[model samples]
Target: MDLTGKVAIVTGSGRGLGLAYARELAAAGAKVVVNDVDAATAEAAAKEITDAGGTAVAEVAAVGRTEAAEALVARAVDEFGRLDVLVTNAGVLRDKVLWKMSDDDFDTVIDVHLRGTFTCARAAVRRMREQGEGGRLILIGSPAGQRGNFGQTNYSAAKAGIVGFARTWAMELERANITVNAVIPVAATAMTETIPALKPYVDALRAGEPMPPFARTALAFGTPEDAAGLVAFLASDAASGVTGQAIGIGGDRLSLWSHPQQVVAAYADGGWRPGAIAEAWPTTVGAQLQTVGENLPEPPAA
Candidate 1:
């Protein structure tokens, strides 16, 4: 659908990847609602879009709260008279292994990433259904959701939930002409920068060292604009036939099949266990360690 007269609400648009999406959508002629927890940041983002000759407005709201989600959606429809696109991109990271992860950490991540998506999508879907004009819901997910990562149990679970939520919503919204899809992106953003364990691996890769064999088929890093392009396409009518699917956008690596494909068979209750870990044996564990050792470059000595 042409966004010339449409409106879009992009959560977390105050900065980073969300900002990229907001800018792109606005440039495409959509009246963009830039939502962020920080009022100043949201205002700045909206101003940037306006400066670039695009229509935009700033809203400060905690997307994780249902009321805030509803208010944000209402603001879009109230200000622009209609809402056409809902991009649920707000996310936070609280990395910790299951053993060491606190209950709060797990709850916070799930609440913001998964529950926040639920709240926003729910509100938007209701409005879209009422208007009978259909709509687009683009969810931002991560590779961690596809393949479990160490020291990121909370994050992985939250991201995985987004994938499942999108797939289900796609089916429910199909008959209504509303399309739901997941945009799996791999950009170097604030979240990645805070991952200490990933630093060594990233540094090694930058130094020309080959990545691990089980590196989950990582795509080369791309600028935020690259991800924005994919989001724009997915939000457009060009992808009308594409629904209930997960489209991944990673530099040159579009397909991510680098994880142990048989992880499910090794699990007992659809969850990881110590015994299951033993069964992985020489194949999974060995492959991972070998890859890390082979690819990890030593730091410069003082």
Candidate 2:
């Protein structure tokens, strides 16, 4: 994806997955906007890119803030002339069961993951339309949203919203030649580190519990660079035909078909109902009992 003169903005690029995306894009020749809430960290990340022989500038602003989003867009335009890609990678994890989770916890997670994505994309899309050149928008989602995890109600809800946002926005932006999509990443990031309570699940996998066929596949995990590769392709012109889709990236397992299959099987006899679902529990339990080696991947070391 030779992005020679293109401009790309990656939020939360100060470190971790966002940093990997920025570096990879820069290596592919895009001038980058490294945005983070912490000014010092953002600037340092920019310097890292610059030192590595890539054109980059840092923007310190909270992405959930509309004003900050505008400022971020302005900085990108000022530094690189025009924007070509926007990766809404900034997010936070406020894990708690629905009952125990404080209202503030839920609000904060939503504000950053969903609202921050909205703020940045809203500003970038306008600029993209004005530039008369199509652009790419990639929203980062998570596996927890696809398959609910315990104590992550807030995070899961926000992540799920990104999928819907991409689907709807893809239609609205198609006429403008801009493609919108979501990437569901399950890499061992800071957020995944909090899942230590899943040790039992891990042990069950190792001990060969009755698990779904997909369970065995879940044992594998991907690295940040592994995820960056997909994001790079999505942001490139090569992915022009792909829109309103969600791609999952993990070690050796893309999981592109599993969701569709599950949805189809779920509706085999028309749609779902509470009674039908309840009736299926026994069958579901039986299936799980036959499965093996299904374990959540260990979180990356903090």
Per-candidate Cα RMSD to the true structure, in Å, reads: 6.7, 6.9
Write down the lDDT of every candidate, Cα atoms only. Answer: 0.80, 0.81
Tell me the lDDT of candidate 2.
Answer: 0.81
Give the runs in model 2 whose Cα sits over 4 Å from its true position.
197-218, 257-302
Candidate 2 — which pairs collide? 210-291, 211-291, 211-292
Q: Write the per-residue lDDT of candidate 2 for residues 5-28, one digit (tens) a residue.
A: 889999999998899999999999
Q: Model 1, residue 71: displacement in angstroms? A: 0.6
Q: In terms of TM-score, how similar is model 1 to the real structure?
A: 0.79
Quote each prediction's TM-score: 0.79, 0.81
Residue 51 CA displacement from its true place in model 1, Å: 0.4
